[model samples]
Target: MSQNYPNILLIDAIPFQGGSKVATRTLLHELTTEHQLCIFTQTPQSWQGLNARFYPLYMPRWLINKDQGIIYFIKYLLIALQVLLRKPSLGKITLAVGASGPSVDLALYMLKPLLGFTLMQLVHGGVACSKTNARCLLRADSIHYLPSSRASMVAALARYGITDMMFNEPRFTPMLNGLDKSEWPSEALMHSSEPARPVIFWAASLLKWKGLSILNQALQELNASDANFSEQGFSANICYIQPKNIALEYDEPEDDSANIHWFNQPSNLDEMRRQSSIYVSTSQQEPFGLSTLEAMAAGLCVVIPSDASYWDLALIDGANCIKYRPGDSQDLRQKLEHLIKHPQLMISLGRHAMFISRNYHAEQVYLPQLQVIDSYLGAGSSKAQASITGVF
Candidate 1:
């Protein structure tokens, strides 16, 4: 409700790499085309193309002696007052909190009464699953977006009465829980003229939740089968040969079986995409499976774990991609065999996946957010009401 577009305040913690970064950055980029936008971030300059500056929440202590408790509180209070003094007008102030950080959320709440602003939280996985996160989110005015697929998350939310009680009307805005599309491999990188090995790519943080152990087991099975093929008169070329010595961090296994390649760190996103044929995800639970999307965009056929509630974000067990039971090494091994045996099928799947990924582009996602902003401004809730109730 001002003559000018609202001045949106984007409050986020530093290092915007995951869901929080992508969602917030996309929205800000879109809104800046028309609306006035200011970003307050811990890492102000890291993210490109933003009107941003570092916001210091604590004052520097000039005294020789250290301060604690009451003095610390007083110093923080001064910082809060400084932030408050710069608050945009009632209608112009729309604070968007992306992370589930309690301190940031609470600070936004304290500002609501005085600023007469609108507050929105870009909800990801934490709020719907954790009671503590749900309670923190109860302080916001609107939930702009979510990482969960519409069906599964809505059904789960119904159990908690979040459908009807949390807000006047809940809107399930779908968002990818994975990496930013901008970070995906480029067209040239995906369709390089240089031939790559028949790769079964598994890229992640190499942590337990990512299912590295299961992947290792699958590799063993693939190698065993490759050995059997070689014994039965199959040429070494016909058998899948997994290249070792791919990782600089870890030692090359002395006996890395044929058809099992282990990659550690990739210099860039394109390199990871280029050196692979089929990208497989072995995560026990992935809210949005960002790596899966990135692989799809890179034109790599994907085989993902079907255990997560959010697995439906990109379909599983079909033409576009394959899905095995989460943490099931046997299932993954079988899928890998199918892909290697029929490389053409894998290529087709990769093409289809790349086509489907076009919808997730930043330009398209940003358009819907502009609609949300228009709706919020039209409501004319000048009091900055942050009652996070649900609507069934």
Candidate 2:
């Protein structure tokens, strides 16, 4: 590590194939341009060519595995000391950490000297909802929230007397959960974009909170609707873009919608973008809807379940995007049927979504945020000094 550049340590579960991974990578790359970055991750397979030192903990494969394995338990204990020692000897050393789930948040918090380093807890929703997140926020030097628009986590922490410090206050900054626009094909490829059928995209892990089952039910309800049935000459042609296994699991059932056509596993990102006209996400407790951002970047109108925590960041009903009642199949059906029938509306929404997408570009959203980290690191540990008042 260079003596002039502030050395910052980032801790999170890696093997980053999802939105969290994308956001984390964007921030790391941004900071590395000026600061020294050291990363501690669960898996470092996907990290290549990044100017950062990586340490892998080798965590469990799944949520369930975290509870049963002796190796995981041992790894947890070792990670605490390893992470604790990452603090710099002089100036300010910053510690940025997050858990894939709530339990890990508590575990991460329990191991520390809060004052020796600037402690920041990054909450991505699922883990933030639990008692563990509450405890970590109460104990940490600062908290960096993914969805800055909401007062939920901030309110919850305030109730416990954990008010925001200057460095740790909640922010509405986008987590840089988007791709580099230049990496995509030219605008000419966008000319052929048209809704051939009701092409809907769902890109998320096959977890219960993702609401794939709810999406399936909503599609069935749309098929059963008299208005939707009569509008399409009593025949609805709906195409679903998802993973192969999930498509097989949900599409093969006897009650599955006959109008549904499944396109599983697009060869690449362009293929995935081309196969769909609209993007839909219904996660129950998303911290930041990265998939929605990606879809919007690909010029698709986004329809998100109203309950997702991150929706407050940019989504507005019938404005930039549309929202359905969370877990309400009928509401989702209504939204989908409307968009499918009104291609003009879809086009308008897609255009608006593209406009909204620009605000979240990694360069705009991430670089500025990383500047905050740079400021903190450059100023050194004085602002992070432990409060003597014992309140806030």
Candidate 3:
């Protein structure tokens, strides 16, 4: 049965590791036992221990920094040539491009015709309207995008005068990120009694769009009126990863509050989630909130921005999660204070969130996606396209 499975070449050209990388790793881990896999990534160390064979692809620093003009084109051409040369060694395989947008995987799109391999394009973020991106998107054999990104993709395609018929085509599929159930903390730990002081967990990169500043302001305000919020007061665990390959104008100030603890890419995030009573998400219009899902799996009461993202749409305020007005620090502060005031509400919410998290177990969520990929590999393009109609 394993021998019958098709070969897969997963491309990871992005310079930095983020949620898309995490999702790709999960999918690769799930596939390792059954399928032959090869990964082309700049960070080979991160792909270590996975059964997939890794090929080191060096993305230039200038390119990572988003440098443009002739130099960028030259660098990109060199990278494309390198991939072209290595194609023979990879064999006949389905090329899986996991990119934040069409632009990120443009090289793969350029190579698709020459390589004659089935292309699976997975878009992890909003799609931008560009002729190049639209062309790449249209050429791909299969496109997997998050629900939140659907509108953006539609808008991007519309720029090329493409109709909504593409969306209804079997090739376009909407998917949500999933969590590995094995990595989740024990159910006992997740449902453990609330601590002396409710510990809130907030994790994300310090990118301007992640709303870290809003969280910072909310925490500062909460700490200032700690006595008015809760009898024991609230403690916080802020896990922030520094953004790579981007210039930032603002530096996150060090919190002087004793209750607020900061972690710079901690290795034990699952353990932190286990100890936390509440989890807060501050990202504005997040394509998909994987951290929030993980927090829910950890049985932490999740408080998220009411920004119509996947979590915001799926979770009900005061039921599974608390939703505050997006980008409003005061609203966030008020929501947190309410959670702190009612510890039992936190526990109830945590329980419900954990229950909801089961729906997104990695295997369950990815099975249909994997089936779609397999269909693409097993049949001709036309047959595969028709086969995917009901699979997703």
Candidate 4:
């Protein structure tokens, strides 16, 4: 193995779409400056000076969903075959990062025998039980957790009858995912002694897991309350920023449209979040809340589920943000009402939220990834090989 910078194989099954793909692009843009990076995808992506980008055999274009699930796994498998055919020499590539977790796992399963590259599985603690997870966990040379709690991973591994002691070797890289500071405001806006605008802003994908139904129920109840003074020319106090709004988007039986605004995704989300007094997220078991982080950066009182999965990302319910019971509209309404009545508490929590969010900035957060890469490259194949293969 040469002492020069080791090459890296970076594969995100679905490129040019979604949070995971966007995260892939961000890391590629950052890492390409120093390390050579080769990305394999069914989708074409252009990155100047990137080592290589390959588009292997894939399903027809029409079949590709931006939210493609099982198809992504198949694409990764095909890409793996193509990469294996390339026949990378021993020590040619020292490390590989799985940007698209499930898909990458399938690819690495096939590629492990063909390539000696150290495999790292990027995880958000727990994944839903699947054949993909069972296969991938066996091949990961190292586990790189993104704001993933060790306890959760341990429990997840236990599902496959894999004990922690099996991979007790020094083979874990714990890091929080990075957020682009530029997307957020320069500084948190100070709360004035005057009251904040009586507005609540929410942004999320219109999905059941996102807990929109619960939020809609809360709004339905809230709109029935005194906040329904919109008839007196007051603007809707609840503005839901999703392409397809919740039930309140269309005319309902109670005609609650006046009290709730169903707006499309905003062009300038940061500015929109700043204009609002509070930002709420109802996602249950969210891996990492990027939109929630943006709201925190904007100095808005951010509220989320009490059992939000990523607790280690400095999310303390009453300390920096508010946590309401998941799927309980009554509890959500009560939490928001408390913030409405206590202006000082809102300001205090918002300020703390912004402070906590700064730690997630790309500069502060991505360092661990870079370090993990460097350490792997520095150690080379013989000495620092992780137990990428673990038997049950």
For this target, which candidate reaches the highest lDDT against the unseen true structure?
3
TM agreement with the true structure for every prediction: 0.66, 0.69, 0.88, 0.73
lDDT of 3 by residue, 205-310 (tens): 7777888888889988887775655335788889887666654433463754668888888888877878888889988899898888888877889999988888
Indicate the worst ten consecutive residues by lDDT in candidate 3: 383-392
The segments of candidate 3 whose C-alpha lies over 4 angstroms from its true place after superposition are: 1-6, 67-75, 187-190, 226-232, 247-257, 379-392
Evaluation by TM-score, superior candidate among 3 and 4 = 3
Q: After superposition, how far is residue 99 of candidate 1 from its true place, in Å?
A: 4.4
Which stretches of candidate 1 lie above 4 Å from their native place?
1-6, 14-16, 33-37, 44-46, 56-92, 99-106, 128-136, 147-184, 188-194, 220-267, 311-313, 375-392
Off by over 4 Å in 4: 1-7, 15-32, 41-57, 61-75, 82-94, 102-104, 130-132, 147-161, 186-196, 227-259, 262-265, 378-392
Q: Tell me the whole-model lDDT of each prediction, alpha carbons only.
A: 0.54, 0.56, 0.75, 0.61
Give one digit per residue, the lDDT tens place, for model 2 in 1-392. Answer: 65666656665543334456555655454444456566676556444545777776544344323433565455456566666565454235555445333344444565556535555555554433434445665676555555542355655556556664423444323243545444432221233655446567667654556667777788667766775463452232222333221211333322324555443333365565655667778777677777777777667778887774666455788987888888888888888888877877877777787766666655555544455565567643321222323211
Instruction: Estimate the lDDT of model 2.
Output: 0.56
Which candidate, 1 or 4, has the higher lDDT? 4
Q: List the residue pairs that clash in candidate 4.
A: 141-388
Candidate 4 least-lDDT 10 residues: 383-392
Put down candidate 4 lDDT per residue, 45-97, tens digits, no spaces.
42333445453535455434422476666655666766776655323767787
lDDT of 1 by residue, 1-392 (tens): 23365566655433224435544664555443345555544455434675444453443434112224455345434544656766533235644444433333444555667766777666554443434345445556666545443443444456555763444355435444332334546642335553343566665554345566677777766667767642331111111112221211221222344445444343454664665677777666665665677777778878887775464455756778888887789988888777777767877788888777765665454445556666765643221233323211
Sorting all predicted structures by lDDT, with the top scorer first, yields 3, 4, 2, 1
